[model samples]
Each structure stands twice: as structure tokens, then as C-alpha cells.
Target: MKRPGPLFTLLAGVVLAGGIGITNLVTGTGVTPVAGAANAAGAPSATEAPRTEPPKTAPPKTSEAPKSDAPARADYAGRVEGGGASVAVSIRDGHAIAYVCDGKKVEAWLQGVTVGGKLDLKGPKDASLAGSYNTAAVTGSVTAGGRTWRFTAGPAKKPAGLYRAAPKVRGKASKAGWIVQADGSQVGILTTDDQSAAAPVLDPAARTATVEGALVVAEPISGVDGAGEF
Candidate 1:
């Protein structure tokens, strides 16, 4: 015991070499032993390599975002006849309100004019006025007292031959016999021999007779001698 003073025999041989290196790290062939031996190293032996918890990081693939070109709008109504006057025009939203009738009277007289105004229609181009009336198929023209009289859109055709008028005969009026449709009824029997007959009066009358010529007199005759028969 007195010799054991070599620093107590080098601390008793470093405590018996740390108790035989902790009994060879607790059995099974050596070196691993950090308390629970890293939880019984049996399953956790791969140390740093067992830290492979990174495989559960599948939260990065996310993409779905793209769409926008911009362009969608519409609303429309119609009616735009033209420069002689037939304007009822009502465009809305884009604004274009017009109404100035004369084409047989709807009578707006020019309310809410808009769209550059000044639709005076033109009429003094050497007024030889016989039957001429066309403002441009009907959209607007014609002013009258202030002078813008451009009347058109009335006759497309049909106004060339026979057209007498005894109030427009209907029926009843037969001496030499002639009164087809003015409400009198009795169509036929005047005969000078022009040849072309038709008789069935009343209900819109229908009296006509001829030896040769009869362009069109449908039902309204009175001209046996007053110089008006055809």
C-alpha cells in the first residue's frame, strides 16, 4: 500500500482501463455504447447514415397558375335607314337617339336629335316636283317650313296607267249602266266596243267592261259622257 503512491499507481491503472473499456462496450464485440447504446444500437447502428428522414420531403411539386387574355363585351340593336327621313333610331349605351318622322307621320318632329345634327334634308334643287319623293330609302331628311323637304320612299313601282276617281265608285248607278265600286254596285254596260269586261259589284265593288282596252280600273267608274270612262 505504501508503494501505491505512484499517483496511486497511476490511478489504479486508469481505473482498470476504464473497467476494461466498459467491458468491451457492453459485450457484443466492442466500441458502441452511449448509454442506451443509442437505444440498443442493434437497430440504430448506422449512426449518421440512419438520419435518412429526408425521404419524406415530397412537398415541393406544385404548379397550376395561368389564364387571362381579356376581351368580352357586346350589346346591339338596329335601324338606320338613311338621309331622306325614316328615323326612329334608338341605339342605346353608345347613344344615338333620333325620331323625326314625315314618311307618313309617326310624328316625332325631331326629338333628341344627337349624332352631329343638321339633318336638313334638301329640297330646292330646282323643284319641278311631279311625283319625286325619296329621302334615301328612309332614315331621315325633310324639314318643311324651315326648308329641308327631301321626301322619298313612297313609290317603288305601280302608278302608270288608268286611274279615274268618282269618289271611287262602289255600286248602283245604271242608266247606260256604270257604277262599279263606290258603294253603288252595278258594273258593266256602257259599250262603245273596246272589249274587256268584268262585273261583280259590291263588297269592294268590281265593274268593268270594254271592247278593246282596259288597262286597270278595277272598281270605280263614272265617265259615260262626262268624259271619264275606262
Candidate 2:
């Protein structure tokens, strides 16, 4: 029934406020630290280093290599005759052919004879004449009729020899023998008696001997005969 004093009203207000505060704490209803909200505020918070992909790597570059080349070859053919002897020959791809004559004059009369080996003039002994026919341009010494004769082929321009027979006193005079040319000069008769002593000759000036009834035909070598491969 009586009016309350100011001090009393003030004390009542204070008590009411304190009671509300205590109730709020007990209920756990006030603002609290959120699990990820701190970082949202632009504060430096525990964060994974910016996941960055390694700078993109470049592929390695490759280089090209150079190619190799092949060797060169020769080209030509030739023949030789002397001391009732004859040889048919040809040259191709560093190979040679020499046809041996059974009889001295028989080789000269045949068209051409081709041998079955290489021709090389630079070898020790006659084996040098085994491969290729480059000897068409070589000069050397030869033995014929028990004498040594110098010979050259290709461009030395020297006569090799001469052939003659005795006048026929009875029947037709048979082919007699050869007159050899030696050391830039002409020499003696090449008889069967001296045939064994004769050596192969290379005369550049000697006329290309003709095979009486023969013909020379050239055959291509296998592999190199056609357009060569790469």
C-alpha cells in the first residue's frame, strides 16, 4: 500500500538485471568463437599454403644428326696382245676380265677373251693384276724372247711388236713369230723356244688389236648394274 523509495527501486532493477545475466550464462546462449569464422574476417589464420601447382615443366628438345656418303667408282674396258698371245678384257665397278689364250696366235685371232679376276698393277708379283683394269695407264718392263722389254699403256704411245712369217717355199707359209719392241725400240723374233721367257706387256701406243672372228660384249655387274641404291 505504501510508495517505494528511489533507492529501493534502484536496488530492485539491479537485482533483475543480474538475474538475467546469470540465466544467459547458465543456458550457454551467448555469442561464442565459431570454428572457421575467424578466418573469414581477413585475419591471418592457420591455412594451407596456397595450393600451387609446380611451374609447368617443359619437354626436352631433340637434335637431328647428319647422313654419310658412299665412295666413287671407275668406268672403262681394254685388251692386250703379244708374242702369239692375246687377252680380251673389260673393266667395270673395279672389276676386270682377262680371257687367257690356249695358243699364242689363237688369242690374237679370237674376238675378245675375258679373265676371271681383278686387275691391279700395284701388287707384288702378277697378283696385282687381279682386280680392276686401271693398268691401261701404266708403264712397266716385260720379258719376251729372252730379253727385257719396257712397255706402257694408255698414253706412252709406244709400239709393242710386229708379226711375220717366212715366204712359202712349199705350202702357204704358216704364221711364223713376233718381233718385240723393247725400251722404245724394236727387237728380235718371238719363237716358241722363247715363249716361256715372255712376260705380259702393256703398250699404250699399240693399236687396239682386233679379234678376227670375235666380238666383245659387255655385261653389267649385279647390284651395281642398275641404278644404285641409297
Candidate 3:
């Protein structure tokens, strides 16, 4: 016979190698073919390594507004919008007292508690005052006599706050309200028998006033430890 060609010789070598591998697997002898042997031999692997995820990262934190301390005792006085009325507020130990006066027939007394530098007070005739306070000023609105007005009041010194006197006139109940401003000016009113009029001048030094021919003391309406003198 003629000598075998190169192709036939190569085919014989391959078959011999495959037989040896099969023998190794069946008899547990010699190096067995591993799952990724082709990949190790520089061919692409049919089964790739398990896909790994990148390590998880945490989210960033957020910013917030700074907190402030509440005021223990403070006084605020200011005028309503359009100079239509005057408002005075006093806060002590978290209690608050407010007065809105037009220096004439329109006035209201409001009382409530102060929380987190804010005040919400109510009174007769659907009167109400809502506001916020700080070291610099108190700003908000007041409603009385079916109308509402906004205001801003700065820090008030002593003798510059709300005042009142409720005395018996001729065995009948009478009431007076006053607001002493930071500029030493004053606005007040007297109400008796369902009638309102301008109030008498108050003696700030002694906190006294003469009403209906009777000597009565005008008491400072402090938010501290005392109910308002209606």
C-alpha cells in the first residue's frame, strides 16, 4: 500500500487522543478533562465565572435648619396695618396676653399660651391674635371688630406694655384698657354700660387712674403668673 497522506495521519492522532481522555474518565486514571479546560487552553469558555456586583454604597446625608431657644419673659408692642390700631403683647413663663386698641371704641383683650416662639390668643367678639416672636421682634396679625390687620413689634422696655383697670362704678361693672408704647406715648379706652369712650390719663409712676369718681389702680397685664384683669 502507498504511504498515508498528512490529513489521514492527523485524523488518526485526534481519535487516539479522544480515546485516551475517555479511558481516563471511566477508569479514574491520569489527568481528567476539567469543565473549563478549553478556556485554560486559550479558547473562550462556554460557562463564564459567576457575575459579581459592585459593593453597595450608602446615600449621602441632608442638611437642616438650626434650632433656637424660647424666650422666658418678653414684651412686644406695635401698630396694626395702616395705623388703624395698636397692639401690645406680653409673654411670661410661656403665658401670653395681648391687647388691640384703636384708641377709641374698638378694642379687644386676648390671652393664650406661647409655644415655640409663637402665640395664638382669642377673646370676646371673635377677636384673635396670631404671631411669632424672636429676639428682635414679634410679627403677625390681629383680628377684632370683624377686621384683621398685620403688625410687627420690636423689643419693648419697662413701662412700655399693656395696662388695664377694672373697677366698680356706681355698683356697676366698668373696664378700661391701655397700651403704653416704647416712645412713652399712650392709647386707652373706657367701657361702661355698653358704652365706650376715651380713657383718662394713667399715672404710670404709681400705675393708678381715676375712673367714674373712684380711685383705681391700673395694673400691668403681665403674662407671668397672673390672669388678666378683664
Candidate 4:
């Protein structure tokens, strides 16, 4: 049939467009992008934010320790029966102080640190004492004032221990206090109104020293009451 030219052209355009649309629908050839999907093996998706975890950390250290207490310190004093001498020792914290004397022939004072049941003491006049110690007994020899005595000491009884000299110099405002120990040695300092000085050497047998031109006579007094009696 002969038709108008513009009308026939419009109908042909509609039919062609409809046929293409129906072909796409029937063949299922159209594709649309998904909202969210996995990307490459390790890459993140466009619509999703990346996820992360916090860093790992170690545990805190503790301040307290087990079995922290150390060994106990002690004091010991005794007499040497063979030599008729006396001894005394005091132990504190990690330090030790000891004295030995016969109230006549020997006297000394020992000081040192206690470690591994051992003691080494140093005193005035280049004196020294080396020995081992335990709670029940302290067996050691003290070398002082050019003499040495091997002694085993325990608890002290009355009238047997340490002694200090009771001697004063005339005209000096300061008196001398000496450790007239049992191992036949003495350590002291002399003080005067003007100044102080190391004590002069003394004759232990006489208990006298020529301090500042005066014959300083000192009586031995017991560290323990009545100790220097013999």
C-alpha cells in the first residue's frame, strides 16, 4: 500500500528500536555493575572501606621476686682456754667487728665484711685478721701490732671480752679513748684543746705512752663489766 512518506518513516523507526530491545531481553546479553563485590586477590573493593587490626604487645614485668630474704647476722664472744684470752665479735648487716685479748699480753680489734662465712679485718698499724666464721663459733687468727693469735670464739661470759684504756694526758683538754683489744694491740686518737693527733705508740705491758711529753698512764677498763679483771 502507498503511504505518506513522513508517517511511514516514523513507524519503521519504532519497529526497528523495539526489535533490538526485545532481542536483548530474550538473549540475556545485558550486564550491570554490582553494588559490592570482591576485587583482585588482595585488593579492596571500590565501595568498601579497608579493615585493619591493632598491633600486638608484650606483657608488663613484675617487681616482686621470690625468696628475697638474706641470711641473718650475728654477734659472738668467748674465751680461749689454752691462752686464757677473751674474744668478742659483732656482726651487723654484712659487716663484722671483733676483739681479742688476754688482759695482759695480747689485744686487738678486727673489722671487715662478712661474706660466704669468711672475714678479713684491717686495723690501725697495718694490722690484719683473716678467718672463717659460723654462728656457733668464729675460728680465726688476728695479726696486729706484730703479733698473731689463733682463737676459736663463742658466747662471752662475764669478765671476758673487750676493753678500752682509761688514760688521759695532762694539760690536754681532749682525752684519749683507745680500743685496747685482746690481741695485744691498741688503736686510739689523741685530742687536745688545740687539735687532734694520732696516738703515740705505747708499751702494752706498762699501759703507758709518752704522749706530748707526758707519761700517759691508762687503766684498762672492760668493754663488758669486770672483763679486764684478770
On TM-score, the leading prediction is 3
lDDT of candidates 1 onward, in order: 0.29, 0.33, 0.84, 0.59
Alpha-carbon shift of residue 136 in model 3 (angstroms): 1.3
Cα lDDT tens digits for candidate 2, 1-230: 98999999999999999998898889988757787787788665686465568898789878776432211232221223343332222233433322223234222211111233223332112222323223344233332223333333332111332332322222332223232333443222212432322222222244222222322121221112322121
Q: Count backbone overlaps in model 4.
A: 18
Give the candidate number with the greatest lDDT: 3
Scored by lDDT, model 2 comes in at 0.33
lDDT head-to-head 1 vs 4, winner: 4
Better of 2 and 3 by lDDT: 3
TM-score of 3: 0.69
RMSD of each candidate relative to the true structure: 20.7, 16.2, 7.8, 13.7
TM-score of each: 0.16, 0.25, 0.69, 0.40
lDDT by residue for model 1 over 13-41, one digit each (tens)?
99999998888778856764466566665
Give the candidate order by descending lDDT.
3, 4, 2, 1
Worst 10 residues of 3 by lDDT: 221-230
Q: If candidate 4 were superposed on the true structure by all CA atoms, what would the RMSD be?
A: 13.7
Q: Model 1: which ten-residue window has the lowest total lDDT?
A: 69-78
Q: Candidate 2: misplaced stretches above 4 Å?
A: 32-37, 40-51, 54-214, 219-230
Error of 3 at 92 (Å): 1.9
177: Cα error in model 3, Å: 1.0
